[model samples]
Target chain A: MPASKIDLSPHNARAYLEPGPIVLISSRHGDETNIMTLGWHVVLEFSPSLVGCMISGGNHSFRLVRQSRECVINLPTVDMIDTVVRIGNSSGRSVDKFADNALTAEPALRVEAPLIGECYANFECRLFDDAMVDRYNFFIFEIVKAHRARRPKHPQTIHYTGDGDFMVAGKIVSRRGLFRPGMLGNGRS
Target chain B: MPASKIDLSPHNARAYLEPGPIVLISSRHGDETNIMTLGWHVVLEFSPSLVGCMISGGNHSFRLVRQSRECVINLPTVDMIDTVVRIGNSSGRSVDKFADNALTAEPALRVEAPLIGECYANFECRLFDDAMVDRYNFFIFEIVKAHRARRPKHPQTIHYTGDGDFMVAGKIVSRRGLFRPGMLGNGRS
Candidate 1:
């Protein structure tokens, strides 16, 4: 099922939807810290490890990120989908997200934002730039430090397919020896 | 398999490596057109759909995109991995990508760029803003028009894992009736 062609209406056009695991981004400003679910993000570069994420201007976390300029991107596995959805539905602006979600905060190495102990990997990031914030509501970041389970703790990560559905990442298939170098070999984070 | 933690070396920390399908971007300027595989991209908004992607200045397509300020983001499936990798490996400045790879070119709706016939979906995008392109090498685009197969012809699209490996999207599981109004359904493109 590779080359068949069919025209799709604009209303139904789903191009590259969500691809990566949903992340729990923790932000801090002053004495308050907030946690929220983030699915709109992408890796922007390799060497400096840049990432671009979209945070609605209305979200409470956006304000915190603006003030603190730091956050932790925590990757949740498939087992955490239900909790992820719950977090996504709830607002971090009103409640103590950590207590409401029963999540733990572990200190990060380089950023003030704490890591989500429950997730598989945590990237302690510092805001790299925010030039597009006004027009696109996007934030550019650099992973100042990162952590992961030695062996995948929950390798079965889930990607949201709008309408409260998901697609679990399965089986590893490499195009062995096809790499052209410059790629980080053991992508630890 | 959830609580174990390992400190990943910063050099190997690839926190959010592959979260979406790798796309082949088709760009044209004047009489020159080029195809380049892109993985560093993410969705930035829902309505008036916005996308953020990073294209290094070294790539030939970047020149075309800079001149045209328009492109088609084509989503390739698992079956097109080889071709995708090949296109990624070769430079568009010297070679005729379409002839070498045997990819088809179809007219687009809102943009001057042509769609890749083998791709599962094509988003006709226009460069909305390029202010951050200098410092971050990021391009903010808005999907002005889109098209997709009525159904996911290759439901199993591939995500590029660093170092020539990839992860295939597998198994659909949705949370029925959980979506609030306004979420895109059966995302066609």
Candidate 2:
């Protein structure tokens, strides 16, 4: 079934991204578009909705994102494990990823990049800083728009542990009672 | 039983950290020591065993880590959930975390920062780059040494979502056959 998504406040991006799941980064420049499996990313800030992605120079999508200065960060669930592995193993330079994988590429609200409709959540991001790009291939982006699946309050995301192994998102536990009033919803802790 | 740890090659740090569990960063400067609950971290590189941590300036451990230029990233298991919540709730400036929480601090081999004896894994890190510190509070650290428990190979680690919720690490799945030979253990994925 196609996932139903609802618009989310960009400020609340930390709720989805802080858990550190493996994400599929989709990029488009001119006539070229590509999707790459990415796990090296960090949430930098909550207000501007910043995230840092380290796209290695070797990946074909790296040049696409670097030139376009925009991309869509898509959260893929455990059901897409095989597809994720295929995307990570193949280079976009050689394959038409969307057509080959039979994944839907829907129009993003803010960025030029296309969002994967089958994914649980999609964050349209615009490049906020390129200073780290030259040295580390790290692009700090502002999540201009966010969309998440409405039904599954907590999606079963996959996290890479190298060597073709992935750890699936498990049970949810809340310590809200223990957290101070100030720290409960601030997104810092 | 106390964890019987075996030394791991720093290059293999990705196997433990790329999964993106909430880590406890322990740092020491002079006679003072501190530990902070960190969720914003990413495995940046494999060769130098580099990891980037976004340590917000507000945390008391920020000053200690910055001054010492060294820290131990400790991976806590699901069993330590309550301790993790308490540590994140309290400030290191006011509390001696090790003493107050009854978390034993063991001398590290390479860094002044002590390792959390109870953690599943400990990676001794040295600050590699601080250029992004002032602007983003992101510090790139090189893992100089690594250690992990022998038993419970797949530890149940916790990943934090906002509002005091956590997602525990779940089942492991491997797609080794799908990965190309080169991508199997290189750690880029």
Candidate 3:
């Protein structure tokens, strides 16, 4: 091993594992609705938009998602980092995250979970797989609806690098004529 | 909706869905082994370290992985951007990716798949889930072994923003005293 890249302790690798952007997820089961910050989530498929996230069984939203099988993934920008951390630190089991965060709930197109109006983009997803929920607390969701800030074109997203630190999206560089044909067009910058 | 943000088409959301870092995954079945580029992979858990990834049935590695059930997730630095895209654009069924790209394969500690020597960190993963393989072509992996470069401290990692553009990780920012005490400290910058 070189002096530059250190062998990360596998146990703590999640800190450097590119813990995708911290997003506020809204889950509703009947009358009980909850919002929580999620840092362990990622895109799984391009079409039908399958997404996977690890939601601990102890989380209040986990129960709501289990009963309802629906939730909205709200992508927050760098500006919302503080709010993201606050929501993450607290649990929805006791506190009403929506009221605590002073966030507005907007009706989504496809799911019962309302979208966080403050977020840069919102994805309404239907739980696609519950097979690994007990063993790993993982949920596979198929995004049934999607919405984003088209005006900003590209909002500065926050990526959690553990240690309360973040790396903001900056400097967009694209490779021309690299993508295989027949993949989506908008994927081309 | 605020003029600052817009709704994104659900079909093309992957472009902005926080497409983590593209990794070179090497898989072997019998004598046929292959390396493929993966942008649709993510961390599904922290403890047992479960990872979820989309491996299209069309790829040669998918078949190998189906039979072998093991592969290595190699994290490449920003310097390997060109090679990352090249490996992604091509397939392993027809050409030898290792010879074509001059990537060196090293022995792994816990898995049969060899590590990519040129990458910064390597995760030897064992296939953990096959339930969704036929339907969604998705696989769940357990990172049984982990290896990383000790030098370079923190190498600049790349995040694909769709198209040919890539985001080079820059300037670390930390949120002081945010993580749980027992979570792990070395993740601190």
lDDT of 2 by residue, B1-189 (tens): 225788878888887788889999999999999999999999888888899999999999999999999999999999999999999999998999999999999989999999999999899999999999999999999999889888676889999988989999999998899989998775422
Residue-level lDDT of model 2, residues A131-169, one tens digit each, is: 999889999999999888885788899998888889999
The TM-scores of all predictions, comma-separated, are 0.85, 0.97, 0.84
Higher-lDDT candidate of 2 and 3: 2
TM-scores of chain A across the candidates, in order, are 0.84, 0.96, 0.84
* Residue A126 Cα positional deviation in candidate 2, in Å, after optimal superposition: 0.5
DockQ for every model, please: 0.29, 0.69, 0.25
Q: Which candidate number has the best DockQ?
A: 2
DockQ of 3: 0.25
Model 3 over residues B59-167: C-alpha lDDT tens digits?
Answer: 8888888899999887788788888888888878689999999988777767788788888777778888888788778888887766666555445777765545567
Q: Which of the two, 2 or 3, has more TM-score? A: 2
Superior by DockQ: candidate 2 or candidate 3: 2
Among these predicted structures, which one has the highest lDDT? 2
Candidate 1: stretches off by over 4 Å: A1-19, A182-186, B1-19, B177-189
Interface RMSD of 3: 6.2
Native-referenced DockQ of model 2: 0.69
The CA root-mean-square deviation of candidate 3, after full C-alpha superposition on the true structure, stands at 11.6
Error of 1 at A71 (Å): 0.7
Per-model TM-score of chain B: 0.84, 0.96, 0.83
